[model samples]
Target: MTTRPLPEAAFRVLLSLIFLVSGATHLLRPEAVAARLDGAPFAHVATALAPSTSLVLLAGVALLAGGLALLVGYRTRAAALGLIAVLVPITLTVQLAPEALGPLFKNVAILGGLVFFAAHGSEGYSADRALRLRRARRLVPALS
Candidate 1:
């Protein structure tokens, strides 16, 4: 909440793109995502807990909801944490493969981005900032 402008805003939007796109894909074709998990090393781990398609759809909902919230910088820290929750299981189950080194590394990078937002939150031109300012305004006047 330092009120810094542009940089963090840009970062949030950019980081949200992958989740937005992937979430849409998951929702639109959950069966496909489930199919992709067929040979995954951790496939058993995932299936043991729940059906692949059900998990895929749940992840999709989390991604889409979190991505939208992050994009607008509304409850950004919580949104980022929610996305991280979805990302960890997906990466472990789907991307941790010998042939998926690139994707695994990509998920790590995404995790880094989410961690930053979760720790710092969002500022400047954001719903969180605007709401905070509004609350401050109300409190200052009432205390007078």
Candidate 2:
């Protein structure tokens, strides 16, 4: 049997969920994540912060905000772009290791998805669509 294609909204939600969980984990377990990045370039940036965890928390917050925006289809392209920014450095610094091939490839795939989302607006069931609908309604007078 042929498989049906997933709806755009459903796909967006699924993708956003990945970031949501990852962001929450980063915020909740900063030390563990920091440990993973111990020798990475990002660790230097984190060290520059007054508290070592501050930079990690900041990154988490950015990820959370971007995920939320993507979930609701609000400024989706911007959200996707933000994710790509975070993912690029992470993939290079954290995931690119001889024993980490799986993770590195996964990150690359995720980056591809984010790029696609950034290039194409959320298709349906999104705040952007709602806003557009509202504007259209205002522009077209009600039939009396």
Where is model 1 more than 4 Å wrong at Cα?
1-3
Among all windows of 10 consecutive residues in model 2, the one with the lowest summed lDDT is 1-10
lDDT of 2 by residue, 1-144 (tens): 222224778878888998898899889999987777776655555465545566668778988999999898898899999999887877876776788899889888888778878988775788877888898898788643
Per-residue error (Å), model 1, residue 33: 0.8
User: lDDT of each model, Cα atoms only?
Assistant: 0.91, 0.80
Writing each residue's lDDT as its tens digit, candidate 1 over 1-144 gives: 464579889998999899899999999999899999767899999999889999889989999999998999999999999999999988999999899999999999999999999999999568998999999999998999
- What is the TM-score of each predicted model, taking all chains together? 0.95, 0.84
Model 2 clash count equals: 0
Against the true structure, whose lDDT is highest?
Answer: 1
Runs in model 2 with CA error above 4 Å?
1-6, 39-52, 142-144
State the TM-score for model 1: 0.95
Clashing residue pairs in candidate 1 (N, C-alpha, C atoms within 3 angstroms): none
